[model samples]
Target: MPQTDLSPISAAPGAAVLHDVLIIGGGLVGASLAIALDRLGLEVGLVEATAPGALPAVFDERNLSFAEATVNALTALGVMQKLRAPTGAIERIHVSRAGDFGRSVLEAAKYGRSEFGRIVVARDFGEALEARLAELARLRRYRPMRFLGLADGGSDTRAVRVADVDGERVLHTRLLVAADGTRSGVREALGIGVDEHDYAQTLFVTRLRSERAPDGTAYERFGADGPTALLPRGDRSFGLVHGVARAEADAVAALDEAAFLARVQTAFGWRVGRFLGCGPRSAYALTRVLAQALTAPRAVLVGNAAQTIHPIGAQGFNLGLRDALTLAELIENARRETNGAGFDCGDTAVLAQYAARRREDRGRTVAFSDGLARFTANELPLLRPLRSLGLFAADRLPSAQAYLVGAAMGYRGDVPALCRGGTQPGALA
Candidate 1:
């Protein structure tokens, strides 16, 4: 890693010296944003707290369900090709409650599609993203860079102070993007408030070798205790997510491999067959966090910075990816017009537009995930029957099925040019 020290310049005096965008964080969403912006020929600088190549492929058994639409976005960005490994295509999803008669089965065949999405290991996905990032010549990466604080933004320039492992430095840019995790330093320095609610639960994740093949089917079983999901993997292994109360998380994590496997098998049932072997288990606190606002004067928040939802439906990362793509589209369009002349990248007008573009999608996703969490955790007899009926309707209704397919595919509103597989036109002068 390299170190650079630069004096902080007054926002007004240094208005002309800033890059087009300076993103503070280099996780998946941040890196993706840099790639998208760089493709549009924008000058982008990504500051990361970790050193380059310091990213690890933690063997913690976790995977992501990349919807067809997400796959298309990554494929267009030249990321999918790098992930040249066998993926588990989810042709059908079965949702049911233990001791309940009604269940919902959503099949891709109903929509004339072979699969709703494909599952890829977290490490493989991260590797592919890293490979594409390395090939992007236009994106400047500053690793081992720690964000110090935010300097005030002027009419043209936004000043961000950062430091490396050695000393302090300052970076000037027109737009500031915060893609750090839920506890984002950029968001905090910008005075962005987050509404966080602890779900009083934790998620236990692990990989299991099963006696029977998953057959490309994913299952979500809701019990009085919590929701458990079984997602297929490439090597005939299954990724399991078991939600437990907050008080029980430590106990679950402390369980030996055999004890943990037994609890998992009992919770998930024998639909996929006997759980043969188990890997180490990891636990994460489950909470719902949302930014009071997605964007401030000249700054915007992406990924977990904007919203951190419960992992009930695996919506957190997918939502972040959408945020990255949406902002890129907006910024790319702004760069093309004469009106964009002297436009402050961190201007409230632009930030507001970005926020508006994202509100509906974010709101809907939050509602969906929160509602599912509530429903699965409820034990009311009347609510149980109602939930069963709703599931039956969702399984039987063609229109409902189509809606689910579209939602899962990530095509909610007006599609972005990049998502439509078209080149983003240059921004206005």
Candidate 2:
């Protein structure tokens, strides 16, 4: 990988420049796709609405728990190696209910692995992505550019209108990718409908320094109100995500540092000891968004654009990363099949294959995240015994533990080659 400058964004309306793929959204997934396709020798274009050298708004102080598969894929793409800060390894996980009689503990060593995944700050991760994107030699990046709308479709390509420094420009591409956020403009333009659900809960995220430093163990505690999570951070501070009812969000946010720390310590026992100090906190309303269709004519959706699930299981980014890698692998495979004779990246058959391959993964991840959230949030007394029984089973039964560990490690159906340990992008058949 090598550095390059931004290409000219203004082109003649009639003489639309054709591309193998035009990805609209230079965030995590889009940038990762550009890097993957760059390896396959394709004319790729990346559209970033944000100003040049500025990180996307999606990157913030929030912390992300990366699954093993996501780690492998990012490492293969050379993005993880450019991380500016150290990451915290998740070697163990503990799950419990505040007043439950039983709990479950998953250890990576039990499954013959050193660690299941790592914890990274969203802001730092975005910096690493920026570093990797700057190193691409052939990526035609259009910064401070806006995706106006979609033009008429062609037999084998799609026309897109975008505006930049000069003016409006028409660009043609064999494939169009919508890696935008939950409220995606491209997906809407493609006539795709989104199914949404409001959880009525607000999650507050921040960093807390406890008496004892994090030792690679992630704790998730469920209560009647919501769930509290303590994730290990690289700087010996714990990343805390405390979920409260939407009605109480304001009061919770307004709490003083000492009061907030006391409430968190009460909800999440004294497992790690007293919380001495904290940092600035942010709040987000939890919502689930799922696209009705993954593909349309000469176009496809990826990342948060395709589906946004609850963050209870920490499955959002990991699932989206898998989507990006799988699509890239399919495109590379199609190109290899044609022996570089130039095949349409947006071929109907190829898009159909991508949808089919992603079916099992998307469904399972959505269900896992949504189900866990709803199950833990139910305050019915009748379900308490059942929840305890389930926890007990997960703790004592090897089969149950295996299933939980597998899902946590992102070993679902039809995994991409790049997600496999030690496998590179071009390893696809």
Candidate 3:
């Protein structure tokens, strides 16, 4: 596809400048959306509050499980090939209670796939994506920009006001995509309300050099305290997500390397053997935030702007990626049908169609994540047997296991053409 050149709008007052899409926030979700839209030959502008190259690189930690579907999307976008190292293929995943003998194991063999998915470090993933973004000629990147508000009462186009460290400016576009993080200005400006539920827990994430090689096996262990995860990374290290009460998060964060390693060893048991060493630790609050509505007149929200789910299943980023791809597909279809004219990509019809397409998958994921968090955290003795039975059943039923795996991998309900490794019939050249 040929790149769209977007010259800067003249500074003259009342000058009309336009883009096919204006994306707020340039994190992974926003950036990915920019690339995807550009691939469809749409003129896109990305505004980011942070400066270029500002993403954090803590250690060999913070691994993400990219569903096969997600991998396919990234591969089609030409980002996956630039990964620093080969991904750790997750052939299997095991979920169980710390003291319970019953467990649910999901394997790729039964699904007729080489692997359920793959795990990659956050830093490497970010690097590969950024590199791909650099090569895209159609994407316009505006850094250090803060979204102010949106112009109301427009049917075909919307104006977005943003400010950088230097000054404020206005941008006009047919479609405005809010890919900003949890606290999104576009979502707020659109009068969109979010239903938020706090888990009242904090997640401490870090990297550990384990005595045993992970061998592409991911483990999730639920205890009375909270859920702890061991996600495989390159080498012999593992990414750790240790959930604890909010009160204990600070103390845990303050622990020295040895003390922290001791605590992790006790909490996670010997499944991965002793933690030989630990890296820097970070903490984040666990909460679920779902936007009551994803779209308004000439705008729509994607990524964290639309919803923020708990990290129990590492679904936050994966879901955000899916949102980007799905929106791209919808816009590409509309653009092709209109021959790149007359159709407002952000019109109510388009926005509504996008929302309707996303409703079921988003609703189910939020419910599943919220329910799983609540179930694992619940100390009620009466629910223990039910939880055990559910796990045992999930283990025994191949169909059930495949369903869960497919959902986790972003393959449920009307997957996008690119995700299915197929091209849309009328996709832009």
Please tell me which predicted candidate would have the highest TM-score against the true structure: 2
Candidate 2 lDDT over 1-429, as tens digits, reads 563445543433345578889999988788888888886777889989888778998888888999898898889888899998989999999999987788999999999998999999999999998888888787888888889899875687888988887778788899999998899999999999999999999999999999999999999998866789999999999999999999999999999999999999999999999999889999999999999999998999999999998899789988888888889889988888997685789988889999999999999989988988999889889889999999999899999999889888888888898788745655323
lDDT (Cα, tens digit) per residue for candidate 1, span 1-429: 222222223223334446788988877788788778766666678887766666633312477877776777778788878986667888888888876668888888877889877888777777787888888666767777789897765667778887765566578887889998888888899898989888888888777788897788888898776789988777778778888888888888888888888898888898987888877777778888899988876789999889989877667777788899888888766655536566456656668888889888898889888888888788888887788887788789888777766777667665466665666344343
List TM-scores for all candidates, in order. Answer: 0.91, 0.96, 0.93
Tell me each candidate's RMSD, in Å, in order.
3.6, 1.8, 2.6
lDDT of 3 at 130: 76
The residue pairs found clashing in candidate 2 are: none
Better of 1 and 3 by TM-score: 3
Question: What value of lDDT does candidate 3 attain over all alpha carbons?
Answer: 0.79
Best by lDDT: 2
Superposed on all Cα atoms, model 2 deviates from the true structure by an RMSD in Å of 1.8
Worst 10 residues of 1 by lDDT: 2-11
